[model samples]
Target: MTLRSTGRWFWASDAEGDRGGPSGRRGGALAMMVVFAAVMGCAGAFAAYRALTGDVDAYLASHRQITAQVLSLGDRTSAAARRAGTSAEVAWVDGSGIGHTGMTRLRGDQVEKARVRIWVDADARPAAPPMGGSGVVLGSLITGLVAGAAGWSVALLARSGRRAWTARRAMAGWDREWRAHADADS
Candidate 1:
């Protein structure tokens, strides 16, 4: 079989003459701009969505409870009865009026202890705010706009490149054929 039949001659001829042909530099630049714009639009949309749907108050309340628990755990120490012995256990009622237990073990002067309790204010509101829906709407808008811009840019670049390539190829082919005819005539 001939090499051409096997697709081995695909790069044998430089269809685009010297100087890298049309360069396609503008097309590449346009494509990059479109991609950058799309990414920015997506990011803006995501931020808007979070702003609209995220519940700031509920988040703060949960964080406050967690902080109080951490503080209580740090301040409350083992009772005197437990401190005297090699192993000690203590029980205390937390702010929530729930009884909780903690145990400490002293091994060669090193003390280790663990405590468990639940902390959640009875009057606290819901953990999350109601969804606003606006954020998602805004995000969708931004995404659509950006995507459209990017697609438009890419399409324009491709169209221009195709036209340029067609013109260049036509000229080159005509020149080659004319040269062959002239040589034959001679």
Candidate 2:
């Protein structure tokens, strides 16, 4: 078998040209599959990045950081709580001077009546901080990788099935030809 590269694609042929035979078709299908996977992966990454960025922007626009006074503290029975902080009840005023109270986690050293900065949404309810750039980038990369892998795996499986079916058919044909030849000789 001889392999040739045509700038962007590589294909194989025997002593004679592939001439649209199974090998040539397989080479073409492989190239197409790679292109399809790349397109899908890039599209998935871009979509994820855009969606995450929009969400961050919305959060920044609708949320604000304000100073709150710790009203009380809750118990932390475990040394390894998912939240390694002191649970405290805090009260703050929104942009419109409307007062609200809620429970939130603070540093372990927090004490009652201590002022702390916390994030609050439009409804003056405590909320988590907006996603950072690194988190968004990581999420996008993971999504792209998953998309590409899934597309490539599915295509490879289909190609393998087609190859198996073609080989079976070819073997059956060869058996039929051999039987016909023996009958003629009889």
Top lDDT hit: 2
Tens digit of lDDT per residue, candidate 1, span 2-95? 2212121122222443322355444555566677667766765666556644554454445333211111122124564345534434454545
Local distance difference test, per candidate? Answer: 0.47, 0.77
Q: Which segments of model 1 are wrong by more than 4 Å?
A: 1-131
Query: In model 2, which regions exceed 4 Å deviation?
Result: 1-36, 81-84, 182-186
Clashing pairs in 2: none
TM-score attained by model 2: 0.69
Global local distance difference test of model 1 = 0.47
Kindly list the per-residue Cα lDDT of model 2 for residues 1-186, writing each as its tens digit: 121222112222222345445447656877988987888789889999999999999989999889999999887666753367777899987767888999888865778999999898877888877799999999999999888888788888876686566556656666676777778789
lDDT accuracy of residue 139 in candidate 1: 60
TM-score for each candidate, following the candidate numbering: 0.34, 0.69
